[model samples]
Target: MTEIPMGPELLSPGQSCLATVEQLLDFDFDIPAFQRPYDWSDKQVSELIDDLSDAQRKEVHLFLGLVVVCTQSNGRFAIVDGQQRLTTLMLAIGALGGTGKILRPKGGGVSSLWISPRHADIGFAKALVSTSSETEQTLSQRRLKQAFSKLSDQKALNLATLLGAQLIVYVAPSLAGATGLFERINLRGKDVSQFDLVKNKLIEWAAVEKDSIVRGEIEDFITARYDTLYRRLDPSSKEEPFDSDKLLRVHWILFTQKQFKSSDKVLTEVDSAIDETYSSKKSIARWIESYLDSLVRVAETWVAVERPYEATPPSWAPQLKHALLDFARLGRDGELQPLMVAAIIRWQADATDLVRFCEITSFRSALAKKNSNHGRSYKWRVARQLYQGTWSDALKQPISLAADAVHQLFWANTPYWSQGEAREFGEDLTLEQVGAEVFPDNALDSTRFYKDYRHLIHYFFWKYGVYLQHSKEWADFTRIDISPFQDSVWFGNEERFKGWDIEHIYPQTPADRDTREGRAHLKVMTQWVDHLGNLTVLPVPDNRGMQNLPFIEKLAWLREQKKVPFNELLATPDYRGNLLNKPHWGINNCKRRITEIRTAAAKLWGFDAVRELGVGPYDNRLESYQEDIEEEGGDVPDNSAETVAA
Candidate 1:
C-alpha cells in the first residue's frame, strides 16, 4: 500500500484515531498567528516531563488527551486544541532526541517547525532543536532550554524511544468544525486547567433547573474570556501574566478565603462552595452568575496590571499605571495579584490610592523578604476582605508612615533615632540628613552601587525615567513595549529588554583602559566604573558594545543613529549638562552624576517622600492619599515596620 503522502492529508470529516507524537507528525500543523505562543511555565514543563517519567516507570503507554486540528488554506493542519501539549511533545522530541528530522511537517523543511509558532519565533524554535545552543535566553527559549536539562542524555533518549504516548487526534475537515470542537474539549476536557470542571457543574445545574439563558451566558462568557486572555498569557509576556486557570483560582480565593492548596484541593474547595451556595438557598444559576460577575470585575484589570514598559497607560487609570507596574513587580510570585484586582474592584472610584497601596504594601513585603509571605498568607485574606466589604475603607487612603521608617533607608547605615526622642510625622520624608550617614556599600551610596545591584538599577532607572516623563509621576516610566531594566537586550529570552541596556557614559574599557603603561595619568577607576551615576538606559543594537568605544565617537554615532529613546535618560537636563556638554568622562563625572541620580532615587524610593510629594515616605505616588475620613478620622497605622531592614 502506498504510504499516505507526508504532511496534511485530506481526511474524512469526523475521522479520529489514537496516535503517538511520531505518528502525529505526519500532518503539518500550523498554529494560527493569533494563537497564544508557547507559555508552559518552568513548573508546568517539569510536570509534563515528570508525568512522562512516571509513565515510563509504570511501563504504561502515556495517554495524553485529545488534540483537535483542522485544514488551513495552505493544507497544513491549524492546531485548534492541545497546542501546549503538542508543542511540548515536539520540544520533548527536540530535547531527548534531535528534532532535525522530526521538526519538519514532512519534508523536514529548513524553514518549518512541525509545529510552527508565531511568525517571529519560528527560527528560535528551530535553533532549539539543535544542540550546544546558548544557555542564556528568555521566554519560550529559556523555558525550553531548562526543560531540555531535566533528564540525563541516556535517559532522555530512552524515554524518547521507548515511551509511546497515545494522543487522540480529532481531525476536522474545516476550521469552523475545529473551532467548535476546540471550544468543547479545550474547555471541557483539557486536564491542564480545572475551569471546565466547575463550569461543567454549573451547566449541569443550569440544565437541571431549566435555566437555558444563564447556561448560554456562561458559554458565551467563558469563550469570550478565553479568546481575549490566551495571547495575554503568552510566556514571552513580561507582565508575569496568569493563565485562565489562575484567574479562576484567584477568584475562588477572593470569595472563599482559601489558599490554592493544590489543583485537587481547588476542585474540592469549588465543590464545597457550590454546596454552600445550594444550602444558602441561592439558585445554581445565581451562584455561577455571581462567580462570573466577580470574574468580570477583575479579569480585565488583572491583566492590565502587569503590562510591560511599552504599553500606553491604561485609559481607566492612567495615573496609576506605574503603581500597577510596581505592584506587578512585587512578590513576582503573584502574591500581589489578588489584592491588586480586589483593590480595583472595591475602590473603583479611587484607583490611584488603591493601586499605590498595593504597590507600597508589596514593597513592604519585599523588604520583609521571606519573613512575610503576604501572597500565601495574607494577600488572599486581604482580597477576601475587600470583596466582602469587611476591610476598613481607611485602607483606601494612605497609611501614615512612621518617621523612623524613612531614615534607615535614606541614611543607609546611620544609627536609628533614640526611642526616647519624639519622632516627627509627615505625609512623606527626605534625605536632608545624609552627610553623617554612611554604610559600607549600603544601598544609599550610589557611587558604590554597580552590577551587584542589577535588579535595583534596572527597576529604579526605568522608574526614574518614567518619573521624569509623566510630569515626575511613577517617580517612574510608563510605556512597556520594551524594557529598560536589562543591561543588555536578549533577543529570544524571557525577561528581555529588546530596546535598552545599561550604557556606561564613560567607556568601562576604553582602548586606553588597558594601556596604562605608566600609572601617571590614570588612577585605578575600577570601583567607580560601574557606579550608578556612570550608567543610564540606552537604546539597543548596543552599537556593537559601544561601552568600549571612545567617548566622543559614542556621542557622534549615537546621535547619528538616534540610539537614544526620546523619554528616558537621554532626555534629562542632567544628560544634556553632564555628558553631552562634557569633553571628557572621568571618575569625577561619575561622582557628580551619582548625586543627581541619588536625589532622584531618594524620591523614587520612599526616602524623600515628604519633601518631594507632600506624603509619607510610602505615599510619594500622587492622589494616593487623602485626609482620614473614617467615622473617627482615625490614623491607619503602618504595620510594615520591617520596611528598612531590607
Candidate 2:
C-alpha cells in the first residue's frame, strides 16, 4: 500500500482540507432551512468554552471535526454540516469583540451568517454580532443569551482557539454531495465503517466523473435516503445503539447476499464481500445505491418491529406485531434481520411466508434445538433465491419460498428433532404439540418450552394482560439498565415506574426459608417455577407486595386488583377456579393453565393456520427477579431479533 504523508492538521481526511476557526468566521455561511435552530443550552456553551480554554492552555490544536458545505453565489457557502459549531464560534467571537478585526464580510454585511428563518431568534443572533441587542422573547434568544454570557465570562475568547482549533472543510460540488458528505461524517462510532469508506469511494468516483450533474445524481440518491435511515434505524433509547457496523453486519447480506465471517471487522468485511462479488465498478455502485434505498425503505417498519420502551406499538396488524414480538423473544436474529429488511423493503414477493419461515426457524432453533447452527446453515443461499435478479444477487433464478413452500424450505435449513418431521411444524400445532415442542416438556414432561426463551415469556405475559384488559396501549415498561457507563434512561426522574417483570405463581423461595418445612416446601416450588404455566406478568410494586406470599393469598390479591385503582392484573377465568380453595398451586394447575395459555398464545403469535381478528394471547406472576433474565435484555436480544454487534 502506498502511504500518503500526514499533515499537521488536527485530523486527516484525504478529500477534505484544513481551516482555522478565525479563517472560518470571516467567510459568509447560509444556514439552510433544514439545519436545526441554534439552541445550545448554557451547559453546552460552557463546555465549548471550557474545551477551547483547555486546548489553549495545553498549547495544542483541537480537531474541530469536518465541515461540509456547498458553494453558493456571491462567494458564500451553504452550511450542510458544522452549522451548530460554526454558529456557536461566530457568537463566541462576536462576544469577544473580534468580529470587526476579521477581514471579509463578502456579503458586505455587519455579520457573515445568513440565519435560517427556522432560527427563531434571528434578530438576537444578528444583534449579538452587530452590537444591537434584541429582547429575549423567544427560546432561540434565550439560548443565544446563555452562549453570549459564557463567552463574555471568558473576558476574551482566545485568539489561539480561533487560530489553533483546526477543522477539515469539504466544499461539496453540489447540495447532494454536501448531504452525502454530512451523512458519512456523522456516523456515530470511533471506527470508520464500510458506509463511510463507500461514501469516500463514491466521492473519489464523482471527482473522476467531474460532471457536477452526474455527481449530484449519485449523491442525491444517497442523500434522499440517509436522513430517514439515521433517524429511525437505530433504537436511540437502547444503551448500546445501532451504528454503521450493525447496519452492515445484519442487513448487508440481505442487500448483497454477503455473509459476515466471524473473523471480520466491520470496516473490511463489507469491502471484501463487495470486491469478491462485484468486479465491475458499475455493478458495485448500483448495489450500494440500491442497498441504501432498501435501508431507507425498510427503516420505519424495522423500527416498528423493534420499538423501544415507553412507546406503545400501533394497534394495527396485531397478529404481525405479536409474531414479531415472539420472534424477538427468541433473541436477536442476525439471520432474520437481513431477511426481514428484505421482506419489508426490497423484495417484490409476499411477506407472510417470510415471517412464517423465520418464525418457525427461530422458534424451533432456540427452543427445540437450543442452537441456531442448522437454522442459519443456508443463510446466504436463501438470500440468493430471494433476490436472484436484483443487482445485489445477480443470478437470474425463480423465486421459490412462497407461503406453500416456506415450511419445507425451513425444513431444509433446520435439523430434524429426534421425533420431529415437516408436518409437525408445517401443519397447525396443538397445545399438546406446543407443550411437546415449542415450549417442550423435559424428561419429566415439565420444561414447558420457551421458558428459557426469556424475552418472549416476559413479552407474552405483558402483552396478554393488555390484550385481556382490551387496553388501547401497552403499559410503560421500566427501561432496564444496559450500560454501566450510563445510568438509567430516567436517571434523575421518579423511581415509581420500576416497570413490570416476570412473576412466578409458585415462589422460587419459601417466605419462611428460615424453617425446615419452608425449606422442604421450597424444593417443591423450584420444579414448576420457570414454566409458562407458572409464569405471569406483574408490576414491580405488585410483584414485590405479593412476592413469596402463599398461592391463595396471591390469588386473593389478584382478585383485589379487579377493584383496585390502576391495578392491571384481573383475576379473570384464567386465574380463577378451585386454586383459592387450595393452599398450594399444584402440578395439575400448571398443566391446566399451561394449556389455556398455549391455546391463546398460539392464536396471538400466529401458529394458527387462519388469521383471527378480535383478541390475542396472555403471559405473567412472581419469582424473585433474577439478574440473568433482566440482564439479557430486549424482550428481544440486542443483536438477534433487533440488530447485531457490540
Candidate 3:
C-alpha cells in the first residue's frame, strides 16, 4: 500500500484532488459515531454498478462524485460523504475474487473502513463481511448479493481498472471542517433530509451522555421510533423515505401554538424551544419524554386527518371519529390539522359539536386564505388561543364562540362585503341552518345539486337509510332526532365505498327513437340527465349491469341486487305515487321522485333553514376549493358517479 503524505499543504478546506478508488480507499475510513447504518437498498447499488459497467463498456471515464473525508493524524481518514458508493465498490471488488485487500488498509488488524465507529456490528457492511449466518441482512446486504450476481469476471476486472484509475475525491483538511462541509453540501442538496440532521443531533447528544444506561435507552428509543416515524412521514417511499420535517413543524405548532414559517428553520427552532423550556438536565429528560409523546400524538393526528375511516372507530368517541371521517372526506389540510389534534386530545367526547365547529371554521378560513385580500392572521391567532385550553376549560365557554370568532374575523377582514349582510355568509350559518339550507325540500329544483355536493349524497343516504332500516318513520326523524348520522358504508364486512358508484336516475342516452312517443320519452330523460333527483348511489357491479336499461328494468335489477341503500330506499313500496313508481318515468315524474327524496333528506338536514340563511355568489365554491387544493399538491376525492344514457 502506498502512503500519500498529508501535511500543511493538504490541510486547507475544499482542497481538490484527483485520486483513484484504490488510492482513496488506502487510508482506513471511519464512518463517524453519529452516522446511521449503511442503508443504500439493492436498487441503488445495482444502479451504481450498471452506471459504472456502462461507462466501462463505452470506454468513457466515470467520475464518481466527491467522497468528502476528514484526515486524521493517525494516517486514517474519516468518510463524511459518499460511503455508500465506496462500500459498494469494495463489495463488488471482493465478489471479483480480489484477495489483495487493496480496499482495506495495510494492517489486517483494521479494515479499510470503520462503520459506525463505536458500533461496528450495527451496520450492514459488518454483517456482510462476518461469517455468522445468524446476522440479519438488511436491504442493502441483499442488494450487495444481487449486485455480486450481476458482476462477471471480465466486468469485475473492468470495474477494478475503472476504480484504480478513474475515480476522484475531494478531501477537506480536518474532521470538524469536513463534517461542516458535509452538512452544508447535503443540507443544500437532496443527499440529506431534515429528518437525518435532526436524528444526528439527537444521537450526537446521546453519544455524549456520561451514563451508559441513559445512552443505551436513548439509542434503543431512536432505533424503535426512527424508521417507524420515517415510514409514517413518507408512506409512499420504501427506499429513501424521508418526509418527517413537516411533522417536526407540526410538533412545533402543537407545542408553541404558533406557526414556524421557515421549514429549514424547523430543527433550530425546535431545539431552541426545547433548550429554553428545558434548561436543566432533568428538565431535558422530561422534554425528551414529552417529545416522544408529541411524536406519537402528531403522527396519530395525521393518520386521523388523512384516513379517519381506516381505523376502527373509537367506541368511546365514535361521534368524534365520525366527525373526523367527515373532515377526512372533506379534505386533508395541514393548517386544519392542529385543531384536529387539539380536538382529539381534549374535546373528543363532544365530537359532534367539535366537528361542527371545525367544519365551519375550515370553510371560513379556506375562503379567507384563497382571497389574498383577506388576511389569515386572525385564524391562526384564534387557533392558538382555542387550542391552548383544556377540554373542560374549552367546554366551559359558549359553543357559539367559534362561529362568533369566524364571523368577527371575516367581518374585519372582508370589509369589501357588507358587515351586517347575511347574504355574504356561507358556512357561518348554524349547524341546523346549514343542514336545512344545503338540503331543503325544494333542493330538487336545482339541477346544479348533482354536480356539486356529491359527498352529501352519502350523508343523506346514511341518515334516511338508517332511519328506514330501524323502522323509524321519516316524520318522526324530522321532529325529534338530533343524533348525528353514523356512516352506513362502514357497517358489516363491506368496506366503506368499495363498490359504490354515483349512478344517474335517468341515463344520458341519445333521443334517437324514431317514433314520436319514444322521442318525447328520450327528451324527458335527457332534460333531467344531470339532476340530483335522477342521481343515486349503487354498487359498481350493479351500476355497470344497469347500463342504458329502461327505468323499470333498472329498478327490477336493483331489487335483485339490494346492494345500494339509496337504490333500495327508492325500491320500497312505502314511497310510491312519486317518481319511483311511475309506469313511464317522465320529466314530471323525475322532478317528483327527487322532490320526495329531497323532502326526506330535508327532514334530517334542515334544507329550508339553509335556504333562509342565504346562498353565496360562489355557487361553485367547492370547484374553486378543489382547484386550489390540487394546486397546493393536495388530493381531492373523486366522488363522481356513473351516469345512465338518456
State TM-scores per candidate: 0.52, 0.60, 0.56
Candidate 2 per-residue lDDT over residues 481-527, each given as its tens digit: 23111113212112212355667777776476677766666676566
Off by over 4 Å in 2: 1-23, 29-189, 210-244, 249-251, 257-331, 346-350, 372-374, 389-401, 414-451, 462-498, 515-520, 562-588, 598-646
**Ranked candidates, highest TM-score first:** 2, 3, 1
- What ranking emerges by lDDT with the best candidate at the front? 1, 2, 3
Candidate that beats the other on TM-score, 2 or 3, i.e. the better one:
2
lDDT of 1 by residue, 1-646 (tens): 1233233454545677666666667777876653555667778876776778777778777788888876655867777678878777777777766566456544555457778866545666777676646543335555555565653243644545433887777777554456556656655544545654554444344444445565555545544544444544443434343456777777666666433432334656766767776788877656666666666655666656545343323466656665665654442446556666666665553555555544443343333232233224334543555555544322353322322222212221112221111133322223554444332223444444565555444555555655554545322322344543332332222353445567676666565555543131235455666777667666556555565665556666555553324233333445434533233455655655565555564455443342232233233332222221122213332232111100
Candidate 3 wrongly placed segments (more than 4 Å): 1-53, 61-64, 67-183, 186-228, 231-246, 257-297, 309-320, 332-334, 347-353, 356-379, 390-445, 454-471, 474-500, 510-518, 525-527, 573-646
Tell me how far the alpha carbon of residue 451 in candidate 3 is from the true structure, in angstroms, after superposition.
3.2
Give me the runs in candidate 1 sitting further than 4 Å from their true place. 1-191, 196-242, 257-265, 276-283, 308-317, 322-333, 360-376, 393-448, 466-496, 506-510, 517-523, 545-547, 550-584, 607-646
lDDT of each: 0.52, 0.50, 0.50
What's the TM for model 2?
Answer: 0.60
Steric collisions counted per model: 23, 21, 18
Best of the candidates, lDDT = 1
Roughly what TM-score does model 3 have, to 2 decimal places? Answer: 0.56
